[model samples]
Target chain A: MINPINIGSIDDIDEGEAKVIPSDETGTGEDIAVFHAEDGNFYALNDNCTHETASLADGWIEGTEVECPIHAAKFCLKKGTALCMPATQDARTHKVEVSGNDLLLYPNVPAEPVEA
Target chain B: MSDCTSHTSEANASIGRMSRPEAFTQNIDVSTLVDSDGGLIDRSIYTETSIYAQEQRRIFARSWLFLAHTSQFKKPGDFFTTFMGEDPIIVTMDKTKTIRAYLNSCRHRGVRLCRADAGATKMFTCTYHGWSFDLAGALQSVPNEKAYPEDFDRKQWGLIEVPNVQSYKGLIFGNWDKDAQSLEENLGDMRYYMDAMLDRDPEGTEVMGGVMKWTLEGNWKLAAEQFATDWYHVNMSHASALMVLSPTGRGPKAEIAATPGRQFGSENGHGAGFPTHPKSRFDARPVHEYYDYEALRERLGDAAVEGPMTTGHATVFPNFSYLPVNGSIRVWHPKGPDKMEVWAWVLVDKSMPDEVKDAQRLYNLRTFGPSGIFEADDGENWSEIQAISHGFVTNNVPLNFQMGIGSERNDGTYPGQTSELYSDAAGRAFYRHWSKQMNTPAWHERTEQA
Candidate 1:
């Protein structure tokens, strides 16, 4: 089952920048970083850096990449690639949608197979 | 002539102004060790300073000390920094993929070359004078090539190589003494135990994650002796973890209460304190539930489950210690007379399931890391031993090692060696060997006789 989270209104942001808002309303344990690219597309990724377990929500978003403030391991906002040493794993990417004035996010759960 | 008088005289004499060499000489004295009843007190070997110094030279310097596993250097120009005794050295795999180790100091002014914990580099440029060396440890470039006359050859100014750098079963060891015994000869019977732990899997064992390096406030010998034969300390030292893990504290107690299988002291100083069966603290869980347990059992067959873990732990002479439970290898590298840096790596068969490897890593961290419960108890006692031993009066007195005296009888059970699977005399034997080398007049004499 996929639950849609209404983050913000479409007119609330401009192109080529991201508006990171608190995920407390969604009731999910994880906080998310919302990105609005220049191509009129929206993307969502887990706000935490996978390497040193740092919060990436406070990091700087430059072009398509978000640089983690702690160790500077960069992650692409569009495609989740942890492009640095230290962080060998990829960040969790979520599906984002915009309908009318509402910016929504579809949370994706990790697909680790349950042990018997 | 009387036993009481002889014992009193020996004890009194040992307390007097005995030089380091004299104390070391007394170690190999089998008669002085044997009690009136002939049982051996192995603890004496654990407490002596002369024997410890001798071990620094003979065992640590001469023998092949495990530096790192081969996988740490996977790519060309990949290098990792580690220490062999007090000397810092770097191990690198060149563009040709040949592994080599050299002193980490720059050839110019001895400044450290590789500052990062680990990374891939085309060349190591010194931070001081900008002197650089490449993967082959060759003097690659200098700022001014003709600064020195034609008499100065760049080839002669390469980083100093550790005399012996060799790997057996994927574990690499380095030695300072060029004339020392080969790695194979030094491993001796210990290789059998290593095979059971490492070679059981077809693809062999690979270090699952990064290593944990930490400092423990104890003499290196104290840590080494714990691995040698100190199973008796488990119930008391690790009572907290054992209480949590075991069905009851009485489970291992019930098994070992009657007659604990004796400690097997191997010819080349490898020691194993064998238990009768595979005793586990895991409550009613399937043996294979621990992940690598079943795969390892399947690989080594009866030996993996029934032999190594259940039977005993093997302390490979000087430094390496292996515990088969979830497969952990600990290498205790001595920093000095009283300080040691512990490097622990979790060993998993290459073919193990990912989930199992994850579990093993977690288990190893919880039990063995700096904050680990088991290591916490051990660190407390080890530090206290070092602290009290520094006292003036306490330092002069000898620590007691008079356990299992007169009970040791060398019966021909395991062939080709003097086998005594009866006592903690293994510790005593270690000290004896240690003292013998320390007291020997010259390194050449020790090498010649050895």
Candidate 2:
């Protein structure tokens, strides 16, 4: 069953940044990174760095790239292409929906999903 | 110079035949190598100085050593620095999407060209003299162009190109010997096994993240041999994990106490030693239960999965080897005769679920990382073996490798390779090949012999 839960309010943040939403009663797993893109759209990717397994929440968010703190491998938060070396694989991306003031995330996507 | 030439010619006369006294002394008893009872050599070959040097020239230089996976350099200007043996190299993808590797040292002042872990840049400017090189390894500019003569050709001053660089199934390998066999020819039968691991998914496999690099105090061959066939050590080395995972009194101790051990050796010096019913009789309760054994069996096929899942290793000759059930690829990059940097990568099937990959990565870290339980035990033993072998007395003494000697029979499966899946002498064959390369004349002569 897919349980939709309220994570955070949209008015709390500015543009081109993210918020870590903790897995609550209706969430799937641990904290998920919810990003507010420059285009005014919110997206969520796995908060873990695909390189050294560091936390992406602590990484520097520049434009569309999140540079891992440990190895500095950049990841395109929207498409999840590990932009540099060290990280040869993409991070798992989650579906994010802004329902009124509540930020809803679906962590059902696999870490490395295979496309049919 | 005259004396050196004479020595060279004399060495050339004995090409393709073992003549070096050190080769015989360092390897198994010379009589046993040719005779039927050759598989008895233990971990001694892995530590021998003469053998290691020979491998550097024959196997490592000639054979294709894995550099980096292609996924690391997907962008035009992206680059990563790695080593081809002890030589520093920079791998880059150009605007044309073609991958190229060049010596990392600057041609002008011999400074390391690339220092960053990885990045995209139109040109790499040497921090020392301000010389710059494009992605294609061409020297683009010099700080003081007037300092050189008008006849100076910037084209001639490009970064030294490695002799051969190629990729097969996303895995890239670089070779130093220009006239050596192609990467395809060198891989040979090992390609089949690699295919089974890599080519399963249509999109092919990608390096999960960055490579895990660590140094272990042992000869490179020790790392290779352990991944090749040291399953016997696991029962004792990893006894704590086994005991914890095993149900009550059901473990390797009980199983070995009950029945004679079962071991299977493969052709071309690849083999494993463990009980026949590894899954049923062994203590794999923790890992086996958690992992999707059914999916593994279905994906790897019945024969690949039927082996001792708990304990087994396959050495693919020269440098690379892995234990599939263990979920790791071990590469022993040679630093020197006594030291090697062990590069281990956790391999997961592209088709596996995300949670499974995460679980496998965690399991791999706990089992094989620098601080891993199993690696800690193995590292101590490897270091001790190297220290002991350095002794004048211990070095001369012939290490016993006489297990399952004459019992091995030719299965007629692999050509130019022998199979003895149940013997300890499989390691002896590895050394035999080692001695053959070490004792043979230089590459020119060996090529002529081939």
What is the per-residue lDDT of model 1 for residues B112-172, given as tens digits with 9 covering 90 to 100?
9888777876677677766667777777656556668989888777777775677777787
Chain A TM-scores for all candidates read: 0.75, 0.76
Docking class of 2: incorrect
Clashing pairs in 1: B37-B406, B38-B406, B39-B405, B39-B406, B39-B407
CA-RMSD of model 1 = 17.0
- Measured with C-alpha atoms, the lDDT of residue B266 in candidate 2 is 37
> Could you estimate the TM-score for every candidate?
0.66, 0.65
| Global CA lDDT computed for model 1 | 0.64
Which 10 successive residues of model 1 chain A have the least lDDT summed?
A107-116
In model 1, where do residues sit more than 4 Å from their true spots?
A1-116, B1-57, B248-253, B256-259, B280-287, B290-304, B404-422, B440-450
